[model samples]
Target: MKKVYTAIDDFKKQGLDMEIPLKLLMFTGLRNHSLSLLKVGDINWIEEIIVYNAGIDNSKHKVQFLPIPPGLMAALKRYIEENNLKFNDNLCYGIKGIPLQNKQLNRITDKICWDIVNQRTFNFI
Candidate 1:
């Protein structure tokens, strides 16, 4: 049988760029606002988890540990190391290198573009 992560296969096929969060959304059911709050430091490499610490100013749903599969965790580790990302850096950055916002995440969905033989250009989201 297919698994929860299997739902993200389509998004993975699209590439591992800015669109990756869409796959995470499907897996975690995390609201865009919550995901946006994530920072590089929130990730706990030893625990294999992503920590989301909700500030007092924010509403409920404070503090969470989202597990990362071994393979994906490895990928994240590599990306972080190769990019020389720091703890204060933002975890999610869009194609234009801007912090990913809720509106932008909402727009992250299946998109079809009219290029060569109806190529699916996901740039719309």
Candidate 2:
């Protein structure tokens, strides 16, 4: 957990665009696939909860909602505004504004953990 926090701090320090999604994953306890599936409409500002829909996946899924922490919610608002996201726009994206794939998210996290383990960046992944 400490390492995860450290990785997040490092991502923030480096001004990585992935910081928000990483924080969301940590705070919401959402699976990588679920987090990657998140869209602007999933967030309920009035209720401060994220609506999770498993239908987006290629498998049987459950619908659920998770409360968003106040601080995270604020950050999310700022992120949405900064990105000019629409109701259906994905919350986390990659190059060309494409929604981030689960593999991409996993690779970034794996790279961060690799860096933490080795105390250096692993560019060869």
Candidate 3:
């Protein structure tokens, strides 16, 4: 399980500067599909909340509200400022493209978590 502390440590070590989404997912325990549909507007930084506006195309649920911790919110704000993230229409664009599709995002996230778990297990051996 990618909990807060582990996620934060991994974020720091990755140095890829794409830690906000990872932190959000780890902290909130959101489904990857729900996360994929998130826009910058969905986040209420002042109130420390993330509104899951709706589920992705194939998902069942429509919407949900997730509480954002101060630490996670702060990190997200910093990431936006550092990256100059612009809110385009209803999307948050990153690096090379618009927000990723659920499958792509899930694969990336799963790889990170798997790597962390594997490394920890190896170290304990």
Candidate 4:
């Protein structure tokens, strides 16, 4: 597996929004499943925190809070603004207003990282 630095560089080369999700995943250590379920309201813009309200069916424990690092917060804010995301919008989405499944999110994210590494090395090779 390539290191994160290489992955990030490749992602940057690939360009635009490619690195944001990766950054979020890396910073929060959130499982793809949990991350997909996040809504805009889950983020406290003023406090710069993400509140994971794990419902009874989904959560093993209970509500959890993760501090939004400055970088992550900035990225998220940019993403929201760029996408013109509503305040009540779900953070992750799929086609035609469909929500992304956890499995799908995992697949996409994994492929992104994998492609980043492969492409970076490919350029040098």
Candidate 5:
């Protein structure tokens, strides 16, 4: 967990993009495919959970829910408000505000994976 947090801080220090999605993936254990399927509509604010509402076709999970930590939920709220994201908008977007691609997720994860596997200080992208 410390490593994950450290990795996030490292990303931030580097001025890298996609920091939120990378941190979310680290905390949620959501793979690239699942991350790609997420949208603003999937966040069930009333229940305080991130609903896997991508449906069977778009999601690997069987319509489950992941509890949203207060910090993460707050971040999501701020991000949404700042970007004026609609319910249908992608939860994670690129520089152009488009949905992130699998390659992007892979690139982010590869950095973390290398650190975890090699027990090193950095695996920067």
Candidate 6:
């Protein structure tokens, strides 16, 4: 966990755009699929929970509200404000302001893990 976090920090320091989304996955333990589909409106500012609507056919729960820790919530709020995101806007998007694909999110995880295992830098770009 520590190594993975270190890699993520490196990514952030290098100014990669997926920092927040990576942190969200770490903090919330949400799958890449769910994280990819997350929207600004899915976050409940008052309740401090993320409203996850799992639309998969085999999903056990169609809807779930995941609690957000104070630290993460604050960071998320800042990210939203900095990006000028609207309610309908995707929480995590690319430089083009398009929602990140599931493959991209998975690549983040893979890069971190590879770096940790190989003891070397892994570039996300």
Clashes in candidate 1: how many? Answer: 0
Residues 1-125, candidate 2: write the lDDT tens digits.
67766766666566556667778888888988888889999999999999998775555667888998999899899989998999999888752357888888888877878787888743422
Best by TM-score: 6
Local distance difference test, candidate 3 = 0.61
- Candidate 6, which ten residues in sequence have the lowest lDDT sum? 92-101
Cα-based TM-score, every candidate: 0.68, 0.81, 0.66, 0.70, 0.77, 0.85
What RMSD does model 3 have? 5.1
Give the root-mean-square deviation of each candidate in angstroms: 5.4, 3.3, 5.1, 4.5, 3.2, 2.3
Clash count list over all predictions: 0, 0, 0, 0, 0, 0
lDDT of 1 by residue, 1-125 (tens): 13323324444565536434654565556788877777789888899888877866555656778887777677677767766778988777654557778877755542321222354333333
Overall lDDT per candidate, in order of appearance: 0.62, 0.80, 0.61, 0.66, 0.76, 0.80
Q: After superposing candidate 5 on the true structure, give the runs of residues whose Cα lies further than 4 Å from its correct spot.
A: 57-61, 94-97, 115-125
Rank candidates, lDDT, best first: 6, 2, 5, 4, 1, 3
lDDT of 6 by residue, 26-110 (tens): 8788888888889999999999999998766665757878899888899899999998999989898753457888887776777
- Model 5: per-residue lDDT, tens digit, 12-107? 676555656876786677777788878899898988888775455654447767887888888889989988889988898643346888887776
Which pairs of residues have clashing backbones in candidate 1?
none
- Regions of model 6 farther than 4 Å from truth: 55-59, 94-97
Which lDDT value does model 2 have at 42? 95
